[model samples]
Target chain A: MSDSKAEASTVPSQKPVPKIKDISLMKAWKDSKAYREYTLFVQSLNRAVHGLKNSDTVPLSPTLDKLIILLNQLDSFIDQCPPKGRSRFGDAGYRDWHGKLEQESQQLLKDALPEQYHNYIEELNGYLCDSFGNSTRLDYGTGHELAFALFMLCLCKIEALTEQDSRAMVLKLFSRYIDLCRKLQRTYYLEPAGSKGQWCLDDYQFLPFLWGSSQLTDDGPIEPKQAIDERFYRDLSNDYLYLGAVKYINEVKTGPFFEHSSTLYDISNVAHWSKLNQGMVKMYHGEVLDKFPIAQHILFGNLISFDPVPKPTGEGLFKKPAPVANQ
Target chain B: MNENSSSNTNGDIDRWLEWIKDCKYLPETDFKQLCTIISDIFFEESNVQPIFSPVTICGDLHGQYYDVQELFRTGGYPPDTQYIFMGDFVDRGYYSLETLTQLLVFKAKWPDRITLLRGNHESRQVTQVYGFYDECMKKYGNANLWRFCCRLFDLMPIGALIDNEVLCIHGGLSPDIGTIDQMRIIERDQEIPHRGGFCDLMWSDPDDIDWWAISPRGAGWLFGEKPTSQFMHNNQLSLICRAHQLVQEGIKFMFDEHLVTVWSAPNYCYRCGNIAAILAFHTATNHETKLFNAVPDNQRVIPSKTTTPYFL
Candidate 1:
């Protein structure tokens, strides 16, 4: 093909090809436009989310101050790069510049106003899917990734709350996530695993199922074989024995059981041994505690609240209190 | 007057008042009540008065019971003079309950001689993370008793003015915290939250610089030396003695020897095999603080017999 024909084919029908200088000028103009728009959006969103009106912006909150420091650091790093207009591939440069601008803008929004940014990202992600069907698009992925990051930030905030608040928030978040998972008919990436190597059912899910079964049997009047599995029976017995030992030891201390670390260790040991015993009973035919004589020491350690206390039957051994006589 | 009968009547009245005052264990049980109890127990007779002699200060016994026993051997048991135990009686160690019990028993037995102030660990949050809450759950199957103990722990005084010289506490100086009374007025009613005023009070560490430094462990801010020195100077205290940091010799002096750290529990948890010690204070013409290693005799080494089944 002739050079003129190739040039003509490359040129668009509606617009004429520009000179290299004009192209560079045009690219600079485009980049500045994108940067201005992006920065304005980020700053406005940040101010709105943080409740920072003109008068209130003098001293930044600790969280906002940290974000500003991070943004300044990013700005300094970005300043080291060559301007987009100077590059040979002006279109590629523009695309790269736009991508960077979007990323930094999203990051700034996330750092400055996390919760609002997260909700915004989630909404943006949904809109991208519905409007463009562009799941494979970089912008779509970036939006979703931002949402995920925001979700993680929320988790961190929830974790950092006071214990009582954290507990309440955890239960609320867990329930909400579980409901979301059910609605989507898919497991959340954050779901904790169960013993059987499956995503653990939500507490709400398991409770209703267990309660339904019990109600069917009229509050568990069914035969043991039908009503309870061997594991259930074993765990029940273990809990009973361990809790009993704990109660007895607490009485011996005459103080809060937790006031001593040894007491907890003893209780944990009993719980562990009970689990081991349950395992052994399920696996072997004979009584594992008797066969492995050392196991007796495990129970004894837990009972006496000391390792190798002289004669396991000392005066300080945690003995069950005698029944109190009625007055 | 019948000298014997009159003296006996006065003694009985004092005893009656003392019993009434000692019955209240809460920290808010009135300073006057505490004064009455202390006066009845130690100051009634001039012979039993606590002299302005030297006494060592120690801090942060996080349930290292054996170490405390060792400390007694090393620092010399109280009653010869006086020893101030700067709180943190429970958590971290396997014997927090035992250690606290022993300390409480000792305090009860020797009311004026031993001083026990509350540390951050004595609060609910520190105990919860460091094993107090779970230990309570396992030991008692109820959390209320732990709650009560924590409340009691919170009511503990922040610092003790020893012979009007050394200031003792679990943590070091904070930029916001300028005086001992500020510490005393801290609402110790709740467990320390992760951040804010309560956390800053409990988690802040000392530094010897002009500005607050970031925490190396990412816990919280550490106050620089300038502020610490300022606080010490402003309070007119010569030395700021504190605990919390684990020192190699169980004690360390920082901030150009202006601050001293004394650890009473040696070989902390058998994991941190450091030499632990207590400070002995004697104020003569010049105040002299003596550091004594407080490791128990029995914990020096494990016995071969105990290691063998035959001993068992």
Candidate 2:
């Protein structure tokens, strides 16, 4: 190839180049051009999720198998970074643990992605490191969770993850992410950076409920009203993401389910899972996107661009219902 | 408005105590009236009010209204016991409105018995971002009540000096601030600014570093033992008591006990699984500190399916 052709190849026409920058305030996400791009990014996540869910695949997903290995290795470091600090707000070991991950994340991303995507390793590593939590603050919240979700979306964007077995991205890969976050929270006693008591969603998570509700919104007979009924707790939580989140509430908190988890409990009164699903979207936009503290931490990269490029309508995330038979 | 518009008479205070005990909220009009009286009273307080000993210094109520009532039930209610609340009465919880209403009533009724210092969460900008503004709007069906409460927040004192020995503040020290006199000259009675000594007193945190560093919160400095020790030595103070971080044991002593953290919000954010504690200083005896735990959660309220959110 000619020198000019080699140089031109460096700038991929399909993927917009990432605008490298530090963290930004909510204004960047609220302004006209950036807001459109941000909204489009959020919408892109929905579309990518839909693609994965709609794709058909059996067990043994190549993408999840590789990503899970990376996440588990990170989890294994918890033993090395044992909770040794005296202060209960957080353990100093978390910093050590996150530091270890940060040092190896480059190699970890290389190992996780297929050999073909080696070129994207440096760009991808940013999302993975940011997804876990803030190392210095020694805290995790919805912002970190959002970062993790974006990692999976970016995975789909790079085509490292095929449209094959889309649902596993939600059911398997994201499930593993939740498990890892739960372990981090449990091991380090990670404080919720943006917790609003019962006023907000779960301390360390918000996406699971959104995706989980979407996962089972149309899957037969899981009623939203069953949330109020204690009898339904075991059954519903066993099969769906939303109920699983409710089960988590039951685990950590020791008060009346209604009083402590009122936001979710009120959500249960919405009659159907579909409306509840939309409400979850609205709630996420308000609590996670509109809130300055959490949104300010979100960074923009290459795959997730700051350009307002419109796409076809049918490509939305929640467009087609993915089959749950794999689970 | 005039101070008398919502003066806390014995009857009004008794009703507020009842509301707090029941974990119920007052009507918006009643809340506004109480806030007015408290705002008027706060206007009379200095930037750093001087408090004497024999008063209990509690920290970070954060709308754990029942837990606060639990403090009153176990330790003793204000006025009779003499309490100094180191700010952070609202936000990140369910009942910020009720919590402030009850505390303001107590302050209006007996201003000297209770000391209310500002916390990082007290500002209008913060409350709007956190849960308090949403809570007030939803509770009152208007923002007027929230605006009234914000006015009350503006008038709140920044810190307190107990018996001219111990210093009590919501957050840690600042490089911009040298002495207590430097803080006194700061013009208060407005929304907390993005920077300066006023914001640092309410926003900064204590770290184990040697000197002052920028806070991750983007508003104040992350002060260290060097500055804390220097401030205490120069001010001739025995200890600087602060309450911002959620300490697992509810109280943390740093820099060889020269600086202490007292967090009264138990099981912070309803799930921290931590105990809450308050510090009591009996001035007559060289300001010896005594600690009290929160009332064990009894699951007392009959669990009912209500839409209202609850905080620990």
lDDT of each: 0.41, 0.71
- List candidate 1 stretches off by more than 4 Å: A1-274, A277-327, B1-53, B184-201, B216-220, B284-312
Q: What's the residue-level lDDT of A227 in candidate 2?
A: 58
What are the clashing pairs of model 2?
Answer: A46-A317, A47-A317, A52-A166, A52-A167, A53-A166
Which digits, one per residue and each the tens of the lDDT, describe model 2 over residues A193-249?
767656676777887777766655445545777855668768656455566777777
lDDT of each residue in B1-312, candidate 2, tens digit only: 346734435567668767766767787766766776677788888988988778888889888776777778756876679888898999876667778877887786788899898898998888876688877766676889888888888888988998888888998787889999998988888899888778888888888889988776677888888998889889988989999888888788899888889888876776766777877777723444444444455634533433432210
lDDT of 1 by residue, B1-312 (tens): 399965764564444434323222222223223333333432232211122447767767776665666567666775674777777787665556556655554454466677766566777655654566654553455676576566556445556676655777676656566776676556654555565544555566676567687654344467777877788788787877777666657677778878877766554433334566677776622444444443444343321111111111
Top-TM-score structure, candidate number? 2
How many Å off is the CA of A16 in candidate 1? 47
RMSD list, candidates in order = 25.3, 5.0
Worst 10 residues of 2 chain A by lDDT: A314-323
User: Candidate 1 — number of clashing residue pairs?
Assistant: 19
Q: Which ten residues in a row have the lowest lDDT in candidate 1 chain B?
A: B303-312
